[model samples]
Target: MSALRVNNLAISLDGFATGDGQSLEAPFGHAGERLHEWYVSTRFFHAQDGLPGGTLGVDNAFAEQHEQGFGAEIMGAGKFGPPNWQDDPDWKGWWGPNPPFHTPVFVVTHRPRPSIEMDGGTTYHFVDAAPSEVLEQARQAADGADVRLGGGPTVVREFLTAGLVDYMHVAQVPILLGRGVRLWDGLESLEDAFDIEVVSSPSGVTHLTFVAKPR
Candidate 1:
């Protein structure tokens, strides 16, 4: 069976995945780009834009894994766009016409919109469903490939709570966001279920990989 995987998810030392007051201008909210600085400097990120000259190290190595071994992706509505993006019928997503994911992408939202196909192989399918339901949709579209669980913290928490994730990679950034959406809340003792391996990058980011223990 294909695994449900999460990769390159950045969070602060305070455990906030995203800050408060999310807007079209501030996608990561008050947290700004602090969470993703490590990834932005990676060669994998630069390569995505057809650019060159980015850090070639441990951070890049982990960042590069985000696009591999996945045929479908499931993301929360917040990750798809800013607040109330559902209000705008014309809103496609934070990414322009050619979004990054070159696979079927499922957007989990209370307000489902018609599916949107873009320049790349990426196609956004809006669905209003539970975590399991959305996972099923993504798995079906995945065609035996693994499904990537792209998150906005809340959705990640939902799937985590449901015990659906098979693998996850979190980049722990060193910062303190006093108030924001946290990733570890209500997930006490989650480490017991997975075999976690931790690595500290020279870039001051900690890479944590979790693989579910066989039941």
Candidate 2:
């Protein structure tokens, strides 16, 4: 079976994955790209934009890991778009024609929409299902490759509570989002099930890897 994983999920020092007031204008809300500034300067990010001269170090190496051995993705409705995006029939996604994800993406939402196929082999399938059901669908789409849990904190917490995640890599940024959607909510002593390893990067972000222990 392919693994299910989360990579580069940046949370603030206070454990907020995203700040409040999310909209088309501010996807990450008041957080304002602060969480991803570490990867934005990496060669991996620059390569995505067809650019050059990005720093190649710890952050870049970690950023590059996101592209390896993943065939499908599962994300929450919130991660798909801002609140009430379902109302807009024309809103494809935050990404343009050629999105970063080059696989079938299963979006969990209450109001499901018809699948939207985009350029670069990315297709969005909106459905209402539990984590295990969605994981099964994504696993089938993966076809032997791993499935990535592209999240917005709430989604990650759901999967964590269900114990569906095989591995996770969370980048802890040095900021305090006093009020927002938190990642660690309802998950107490989560470290008990997963063996964690921490690595600090020069960019001032610490990467924490959680590998599920044998049951």
Candidate 3:
């Protein structure tokens, strides 16, 4: 079966997925970059960014595992770019020439826009439908491969609350953001609905995996 997974999703010690005031300059917000310090220092991330010879450890291993999975991806409007920028004709994406995603990416947006083809076989498909509709389209495009939930908390929260996600891997960072975009804010009964398994690495990053119980 094809699983819908969120891999290497970082969350603060206080359960915030992203910090406040997300913009082009501050993608993750104030202290949000601290959550991803482990990833940035990994060899896997370096290789993806066209660098070489990074630290080989638990962090690198986890990063490599995340980079390998997911044939297709689904991101929210905010995850792609600013909502207002969608109306502009010149704005393409935050990534200038080459994007990190090498597979087909379907972006959920209210506004309509033409498909954008980027380098490395990555094409962004703008979907004007609901989250379920976008997931259905993504499943079809994935073709037996897993669908990755790429997001800015809101998108992932929707999928989780809807009980559409098959598996989720969240990397709980050691830092505390205090206040920001939370990952489990909207879900009222998530703990009761799904079974969560916890795993810890040497780098103090905790991985939480959630799987829905059979109904």
lDDT of 1 by residue, 13-93 (tens): 989999999999999999999999999998998987799999999999999899889999999988999899999999999
Task: Tell me the TM-score of each prediction against the true structure.
Answer: 0.97, 0.98, 0.91
Q: If the candidates were sorted by their TM-score against the true structure, best first, what order would they fall in?
A: 2, 1, 3
lDDT of 1: 0.94
lDDT of each: 0.94, 0.93, 0.83
Which residue runs does candidate 1 get wrong by more than 4 Å?
none
Clashing pairs in 2: none
| Candidate 3 lDDT, 1-215, residue by residue in tens | 77788888899989998888777788777865798888888888788779987769867766786756578999888878754777787777788767888888998888868898999878889998877888889989888888989886889998887778887778899888988889988788787767998878778888787877775
Question: Of models 2 and 3, which has the larger TM-score?
Answer: 2
Candidate 2 runs further than 4 Å off: none
What is candidate 2's lDDT per residue for 1-215, written digit by digit as tens?
Answer: 79999999999999999998898899988999999999899999999889997989888888988989999999999998889999999988899888889999999999998999999999999989999999999999999999999998999999999999999999999999887899999999999999999999988999999999987
